[model samples]
Target: MKEIYSNTQRAILWLGDYSDTAVPSHPNAVLSRGEVKAAFGIAEDLAADRHHDTPEDREIAEGYRALDALLKVPWWQRIWTVQEALLPKHAVLRYGDTEMPFARFWKAFDHYFAQSYRECCGEYWLDFTDTSSNVISCLQTAIDYRRLLSHDQGLVFSVLISTFRGRLATDPRDKIFGLSGLAGTLVADYSLQPKDVFMRAIRTTITDSGSLAPLLRTPEPDRAKDLPTWAPDCCAKLGPEAQHSWDMVWFGLFAAFDAAMGTKAAMLNPSAGPVLPLQGLLVDEIYEVVVHGICRDRDEFCAMARRWQHTTETVAKRNHGVYPRGGTYKDAFWRTMVGDMILHEFDAQGTGQSRRAKASDEANCRMLWNPNGDHSMGVPFSRDRQFFTTRAGLIGIGNPGPKVGDAIYVLLGGRVPFILRPTPKKQDGATLLEYVSPAYVHGIMDGEVMKEKREPSWVHLI
Candidate 1:
């Protein structure tokens, strides 16, 4: 046991070292506006070539067409664009920067929309009636935009799931919806934060006691109706434009969650054998831990907690047989080991270490909260000074109980990866600390972590 713990600790520290060395120079930095535009232009040019003899070319063309359509939509018509337009005005209102009226903002939006439309698609007409195929083109554009902007796999998965759920509610062709739904789900899952968005959506729609009963009672098409009352309300409140935006965002979150979970799980138990079902549960648990970590830094803990509950419920699938399967127990064990090491490392580090670490974490958070500089209103440590101080204190040694556990749960279950999990259970039920020793080792000795596979078993159980 001591050897295993030591090896694991060493591996973790090594990983941190590598991460520190490599993360700063990562080539896939956030895309600049010019880059984004150039990519779009290239895609559009490729799409305009309708005489592609190959099926792949045809598909690519179709995608480009969709992108072109989306680009044509007036900035005001798109929620994201509208939000961007509103930001300056909002900032002005908040910071007293020459009070601008809402009307002025709207006019600015219109002007920007007109200019963007001309630049992107060579059109200037304001009325949709003048354009013969505006609706279809707009939908296609939205779809294409979703495809391009959905760089993150989890966000893609969430969007796909939303698309699937939406079709399940409205569309009649099961196979069409199913295929599209699966694609959307996968994309969203890979691209978005599944627990933060979709799992919560499911939990909010379906309750603990009521989850399985309705599925057993209804056909596949009607199964969604069994969802709890909050589901529809939540969906409705997101609004149509926001819904589209979230579809992409959620997919990114889901993908990240899956990747992080799968990687961590593979590292923890290299010899878990081929219990695929258990593997799925482990992935879910890893996701939960990541979410918990992220949520710990935010004041909206309850929202994150609710998200965790929803995620667990989603992964459990409300099947009694699967619920008792002990994968989550193992996941808990790994989380404890990892969480303790992270906590101890943070605690042991002086102010310099804390500042360095906090800088990276804050940068990641800012990226997550991209386009919203003042987005950390409810977070625990938003400012650089606050983040540095809080992180320094948090890294200090202490009883890894509710705080650690809460953090772990949130990271695995929340929208971000800010929280940390509690320590593992010892023979006497005390939290273990062997992994935190400086000489401790880490890394997976063996085991092929499941990568990028979608399991519908969870839905069946639910």
Candidate 2:
């Protein structure tokens, strides 16, 4: 596994590492704006949404079907290619007989998105419409999966696990072991069992750097299995709730813990592996579970939004209107639901053009109370999923599976409080409390619950 990860034995040439001779200085090889636009034009003509009128359009459309065919290939969705392409010092992408520098391809791709965005906003033309928007968007989204590779190279293990979870892998274990090189200090020992590999990787990470932020980005724990809720199964795909965990700032979550005390030590018994102990405060119990109704269309979404509004209103009224006159709490709720969206005041306020109104505006038009001058900012809500409110009335976004009995705890070095369900076990005539599932509680993610001066307790995960 280590040798496969190291890429020491593979002699096959990957997509990005092609020689300079392959990518000649020909005009066809150059990724120019005009070339991209022409390619997009061909894509637009081939799309079923719009009708092609001219003979020139039909002729150009036929010429680019090969390009469309190439784009549709699952090559981009392959996991092995991603690691192989990213690890090399110099890389270039090749399509059929043509070759182009990988850096230039990325630049062109970014430019295409920007161009389409500009067109959408009426920057280029007030009536501009992109027919090939879907094609460009898909490729851009794929590129985004690798964005962390360049941004923060240190957290490569977490980054790879987060980004490429959707991609295809032949072996389930390859999902965890393939990108070990990018993990900086977090390397997997091939000797460990495949199941143990993932757990060890996460444990090693927590042991090396006494922070639990990595645990937050993990997949939901299997309810029937004994696997630690804190340990993510890299083999499984990350759901919508766990998707945004990668984007969170680690230091910000651990700021309070770091400020008060130095880094917490990990209690690991190397001989006896599965029992890793952590000390943290038990924050609160989940009394209510609110599953947002599935909204397939406009009317359904609006109705759900109204119901959500009413729920928030009732909750606020019971608390004697803890929010100010502006209904900021209601706005915060919607923002949390949307999670990490950048909205503008005018954009939220409908333009009265029904066709032009965005889906976000259609669902909810409220804005967060921003004292700062900036109009656009990413909200901290986990977004695109259902969340729950704890007994203490703290808002949280975590696994939708945890029920009323599950308890939330803020571990000493953890960035987010985990949702642990207390199971009654009669062991040696004494009832024991065994905690399950280390979940992400939204509001208390930044260790605000820890500042309450509550005593921390040790919970053993069996």
Q: Residue by residue across 215-257, what tens digits does model 2's lDDT show? A: 5453343332655555556665434422333333221233222
Model 1 agreement with the true structure over 239-282: per-residue lDDT tens digits? 24322332222122222232224232111121222110101212
Candidate 1 TM-score to native: 0.26
The candidate maximizing lDDT is 2
lDDT of each: 0.25, 0.48
Candidate 1: residue 189 Cα off by (Å): 25
Task: Show the lowest summed lDDT stretch of 10 residues, model 1.
Answer: 434-443
Give the runs in model 1 whose Cα sits over 4 Å from its true position: 1-158, 164-239, 257-461
